[model samples]
Target: MDAPSGIISAIVTGLVIGVLGRLVVPGRQAIGCLMTILVGLIGAAGGLAIANAIDAAWLLTLLLQIGVAAVLVLITASATGRNQ
Candidate 1:
């Protein structure tokens, strides 16, 4: 993929993963869209790295991504003192 498409893909993936992560969480989060996207991007990258290392399947990879995003969301919320 080219740079532009890769960037766009990353944003789209981040938005989806971020929303999924937020939904999976037990309660409402105090973070905004941008924070969620950032969390999602980091989570996706981390999850991909771990998945690659472990040779995880596609479903497992996605689950890992969402799980990582959820964890990050929790951390971010706590760090910001806005967990609700």
Candidate 2:
């Protein structure tokens, strides 16, 4: 894909991954949508980096991204004391 489309795809994928991460966690978090998106974006990039370094499969990479997102969400929620 072209640069713009690639970026767009990343954003979309990041959003989905972020939502999936949130869903995996139990209880309601007080974080906003924007914060969630940011977490997803960071998770996606970080997970992808590690996955790529290890030559992980596409599915594994996606799962890793979601996992990372979940961890990030948990960290943020705890740090902000949004949900205890």
Candidate 3:
């Protein structure tokens, strides 16, 4: 994919993954949309790395991505000291 399309796809994926991660986590998070998107981007990248290493299936890859995002959300919330 081209650079522009890749960036756009990443943003859209990040938004979906971030929201899904937030929904998976319990209670409220103190992070904002940008932070969530960042977390999602990182999580997606990490998950993809791990999945590639393990040769995981698509479903498992998605689950790993979501799981990573959830952990990131928790960590971010704790770091911000506003997880309720």
Q: Considering every candidate listed, which one attains the maximal TM-score? A: 3
> RMSD (Cα, Å) of candidate 1?
0.8
The global C-alpha lDDT for each of the candidates, from Candidate 1 onward, is 0.93, 0.89, 0.93
Report the lDDT tens digits of candidate 2 across residue range 1-84. 699999889788878878888988888888888888888999999889989999999999989999999999899899999894
- Which sections of candidate 3 miss by over 4 Å? none
Q: Name the 10 consecutive residues with the lowest summed lDDT in model 3.
A: 14-23
TM-score of each: 0.95, 0.88, 0.96
In angstroms, the error of model 1 at 76 is 0.3
lDDT of 3 by residue, 24-77 (tens): 999999899999999999989988899999999999999999999999999999
Q: Return the lDDT, model 3, position 26.
A: 92
Better of 1 and 3 by lDDT: 3
- In terms of lDDT, model 1 sits at 0.93
Query: Which stretch of 10 consecutive residues in model 1 shows the poorest summed lDDT?
Result: 19-28
What is the TM-score (0 to 1) of candidate 3? Answer: 0.96
